[model samples]
Target: MAQDKIVFVYITFPNSEEAQKVGRILLEKRLCGCVNLFTNINSMYWWEGKIEVSQEAVLIVKTRESLYPEVEKEVLKNHSYSCPCIAKIEVSEVTPCFYRWLLQETGVEI
Candidate 1:
């Protein structure tokens, strides 16, 4: 994917409140154009050399690829987990109108 293309940053939070808090911060800072919150997600993963299971809320941050660092930094600063799940998934395609809107919302020149 192109460096300037948009991406979806997937982040897992302990609960909805924390997810919303961080999502709002990212929006207010214009680090991300939009955020979608998916709460009450069942997650199972390996941590500390053991399998762990928990209920978590997911925050999908829509932002440009170039702004990933800033988005990550802000998330790390506000996240409650010492090792939070922040993964960037590149968007292969997006509608032209939506792309322009996203860029505009994030304060990027279209």
Candidate 2:
């Protein structure tokens, strides 16, 4: 996003309710400024020596890199599963308005 800001956070939940729960927790604690939920996603992964594919709700979190650790911690704390999926990637593009709002809302230096 923006010139110097990064929105590197994504997490997947078993369902909409779990996604909503994690999203609200992050926002309430200011660990994240925005979290977009994608209700339909096909995830294929290997777990416990088995390949599994299933539909899941994905959470796209927008926040500074500085907040990543805290965001992950909070997600783990509120997540329903013992081990959750958290995929953090660097954002290469975002609208200026969205970036500004994100930075301003999170109280992060830009």
Candidate 3:
């Protein structure tokens, strides 16, 4: 595993309410440093052998790579969907100040 790698976990919610709820849970648990919620986004995807389109809320979760498993678990537990889109994308580059703040906010270095 890469050392001190930061990742962004993307998850889509049916509505802004759900997004805010899960975001708060993740923050309270210290599983993520920050969550940016984008509401009223249109998404089209294949589900149940059919194409579907809907307005969804997107959550951009910022956390350390080491905490991804826990983050996944929490999202699965709290999310409404049977199979939520919880994906972790690694951050290849981050400034020292922001990285330090992220680690501090997440208590990853404590």
Best candidate, lDDT-wise?
A: 1
lDDT of each: 0.93, 0.83, 0.92
Model 1 residue 69 CA deviation (Å) reads 0.2
lDDT of 2 by residue, 14-72 (tens): 88888998888888888777788999788999879999998899899989777888888
- Cα lDDT of candidate 3 equals 0.92
* Backbone collisions counted per model: 0, 0, 0
- The candidate, 1 or 3, that scores higher on lDDT is 1
Regions of candidate 2 where Cα sits further than 4 Å from its true position: 1-4, 46-50
Please give the TM-score that candidate 2 achieves against the real structure: 0.80
lDDT of 2 at 6: 71
lDDT by residue for model 1 (1-110), tens: 45479899999999999999999999999998899999999999987999999999999999999999999999999999998999999999999888999889989775
User: RMSD in angstroms, candidate 2?
Assistant: 3.1
Lowest lDDT sum, 10 consecutive residues, model 3, at: 101-110
